[model samples]
Target: MEIRWLEAFVAVAEELHFGRAAARLRLAQSPLSQTIRKLEKELGTTLFDRSTRSVALTPAGHAFLPHAHRVFEELELGRQATRATAGVVYGTVSIGFSGALNHLTLPPLTRAVRQRYPEVQLSLTGRVMTGDGVEQLEQGGLDIAFVGLPIDPSPVRTRLIGREPLGAALPIDHPLARESAIDLADLADEGFITTPAAAGSALQELATQACVKAGFRPRVVQEITDPYMILTLVSAGVGVALMSSGVAGIMPSSATFVPLRGEPTYMDHALAWLDDNPSPVLKAVLALAEEVLPTPER
Candidate 1:
């Protein structure tokens, strides 16, 4: 039966008097009695025993009362849930970050999101290579990504969040590590450990360009994907590699990070997302990024 029919049935069942039930429902007596009669006919059972002066529930009316009350209860709960969800930002937002950049970026951004938009769930994917992050964003898998640059402009939009000085990761016992800052030329004769150029590591280009500018081509002995592994290889004296100064925060003790001397070199970290991304939560996140992330220093 219809919900209004059930409402009428419940009101009449409770009041046990047609006039009183109509008054409680804010309906006129004739319409209220007609609604109850229609409900009983739809259910194929008599719901009330009525006389000129009194009205009382039949056995079937007693049996249906509790179930009818439960239906209304469920409808109320559904309304409450809808209202609550409408007032808050509630959805899952997948965020991707390259492993190398997480130490410098993810924690602060995550903290700010948790504080400001707790209703928005964060699905974090770590070790997402810069290129992979962009691809994920374009494919609708990632809502936002913190990635490295040398990123060619595409359908995805990017905003520079931070720029860090490029530094050399050297073995603790390496002669260059003794200096406060080491020039790129100081490592001219050193074999280098680096991520593959095809892996879309922005530092790979920076390293190659800086070395060429320093008048030497690096002899890359090991090509790795993970920055931590690159550090491990350098610690074992595999070779020197260029990395952001922030790497020092998570670098293993076996390696030392020394700022590169001479003309300054920088690596950019940016927030990238599909230009057409339609998530309202993504918009909220970008606004928060503006507030929480440091402005990129040229």
Candidate 2:
């Protein structure tokens, strides 16, 4: 039977009133009735029990209803996929972003996409670290990602989009907090609060390793992943933290941010996607990012 016949059948089964179903489908009642009749004849079964006053689904119709719904759903999904592949102005692009990059990058990127590709949908997944973002991009869960660098750029193509220097976050009352700048070596005696290595905190790893290179190992008192929470721990006087400079703007009032002295240390942010990914929406998003953010010199 034709798909339209199935549509008519399902609509009628739901509404249980021919006039209402016909009105809902924007079809004349007589033609809708004819389509249902044709569908029932093709199946060699009576689908609906009709009276002068009302209509109800027969046992056969009840069993067929679910299958009809599935057919329509699958067909519609296929249509949308085909349209998206054809570069139609539709479909969704899922983006994964690290927490540190969220405040600086996500809002403007989302607004640009919505403005340029109004019909395309944007799905944002935040707080994903570089390692998880890389995994998600490979598994097709994310179309693109803004990740902290020191990532293995192999297999997935990545481009540097932004950079922020690593800085010290200290309790406001700490003696060292009075310094406009603090060297990593000077903080050796203090406990450190940082993200876990397994959480793929490239910046934290870099900071800790730098401390090690400076003739002292960090005594980490807290291992947390969320950027703001790390700052909160610092503010509570738990330990000093090495965090991105951007945190200075939103860090807790009890915490003070100081530039790291003696080296131009920085955390690089990059946009990454599977090299084999052939999404046109991804292409459009990259173009927008190029225009909005300053790309690192190759």
Candidate 3:
């Protein structure tokens, strides 16, 4: 029998009266009764016992009630899942990023995405949001990412999200920290802690550019992977490092932050996604990113 027949049967069984069942199902009594009879004939069992004055369930009706409710529940659940996928309200997206994401716009962006699309889980990978991360996004391994600019930009589309002022991380007692704004020339003689060559090039590029702008090449004393480690090295007076102001939150106690001069060599933060043909979910994420960032003129 058709699902309509099963539905009519369920309503009639629940209400135990032809008129009330029809009212609940938004149908007329005669049609509802006929539909129930058809279902009973197909199943070869009567679903209800009716008299001129009373109505009751047959043993078969009791057994079929739960099954009918379950079928409808499962069907509705399947429909809801489909709608959520279409709207990107529910799905898992793989994301890749560097260890120092908390140093830029990424923190609030991820937080906003989580708060709004609670069902769209992000499966994060990679310590640096760079080459491999961009490649994975093109390969369908990642959906969207927060990364440094000046990437190869071969297969991925990127939007410049925001720019934050770069800061100098120096020992609290370091003489350069006394400057109103730390000039790159001031750090020229100071040893610098840098990021790994293979992981993230953003930090390395920032240091190099800042020093060149200041008329000297920075002295790289050591390269470390973790931001906190870089801070610890500075705290121990190994050298100073340059990065966005957001890095201030995770700095070691011995290190103090000082502003960078002449635009601070602000790191460009971009959101990267597949360029050839982005998915609906990716489109939604890009739109969300745009909303979070302000317009160019503003």
Candidate 4:
């Protein structure tokens, strides 16, 4: 019915907790609960199953979630198109990016903006990890960011641009480097190099989870923010590192990237910005990115 109703529904569905969802929306728990009740009555179906201990999405909620997302996406597109037609496209947009994206997604997007929207200037900050990037967007310090995916959606709007399976970066002389592919369980005892947990690296999370699934926790020997430095450490035989398969092209000569066998671990790349950001320059860049940076085929 109302946009607020959809907003409450989506938030509650994502969090699966009324209190957390209310906190995320900056609304009182009572009001949020009422909104959901009103929405359910209007739709003639229950959206969530609530109990004293836990909350779960009902079948109807699961079916309606994607449609709610599409409604917001279409509304955003309409606003961007209207602004573009108004020709208010000249302004500076600040961008933040993690080290992993510097060589992958950032270059082409920046180049396209430079060529097409020369009147618009970009101020860029490098080596900002996903958590930091999301914070910057919420704080209005960054107009947009290239960040790792699966971040909290409550803070910013995001569009997924790329994804790839993670692989191991090992010293060329390492025994596993000689194999075409190795099981992740094989490296359980080996020390690993990864980005800092505080940096909010999606790769670090995914790799750790993969290792756990393979029946062992990764023994992290070092933490580095820069993906290149992580690879360099691997080359030096300091510790093995888990990296995106897409980054193999940039690997150092002393390091070899080996794909992980069995269940795959993937890293998703995305562009994020505050949904309320009204900069026409940001709108123009987003439009251009839509045209130039379509998700790569697997």
Order of the predicted models by TM-score, top scorer first: 2, 4, 1, 3
What TM-score quantifies how close candidate 3 is to the native fold? 0.65
Query: For candidate 4, which ten residues in a row score worst on lDDT?
Result: 74-83
Best by TM-score: 2
Give a tens-digit lDDT track for model 1, residues 48-135. 9999988888999899988998797567546545645677655567898867656878888889999998977899987677887888
What lDDT does model 3 reach? 0.75
| Every model's TM-score | 0.69, 0.70, 0.65, 0.70
Error of 4 at 266 (Å): 1.1
**Sort by lDDT, top down from the best:** 4, 1, 2, 3
Clash pairs, candidate 2, are none
Tens-digit per-residue lDDT, 1-298, candidate 4: 8999999999999999999999999999999999999999999999999999999999999999988987876676576566578774566789998765458788899999989987677999987888888998997689998887799766598888988888899999999899999999899999999999988887788889988999999999999888889999999999998898988888889999999998777788889998788666787799899887787665
lDDT of 3 at 92: 59
Residue-level lDDT of model 2, residues 1-298, one tens digit each, is: 7889988998899999999999999999999999988998999999999999999999999999989997875675566568777766555788987675367877788888888888778888877788888888887789898888778655777888878888899999999898988778898899998887787767777787778877898998898877778889999999998877877888789999988887667788888888676665677778888887768664
Q: What range of 10 consecutive residues in model 2 has the weakest lDDT sum? A: 72-81
Give the runs in model 2 whose Cα sits over 4 Å from its true position.
1-88
Flag clash pairs in model 3.
98-127, 98-128, 98-129
Candidate 1: lDDT of 295?
74
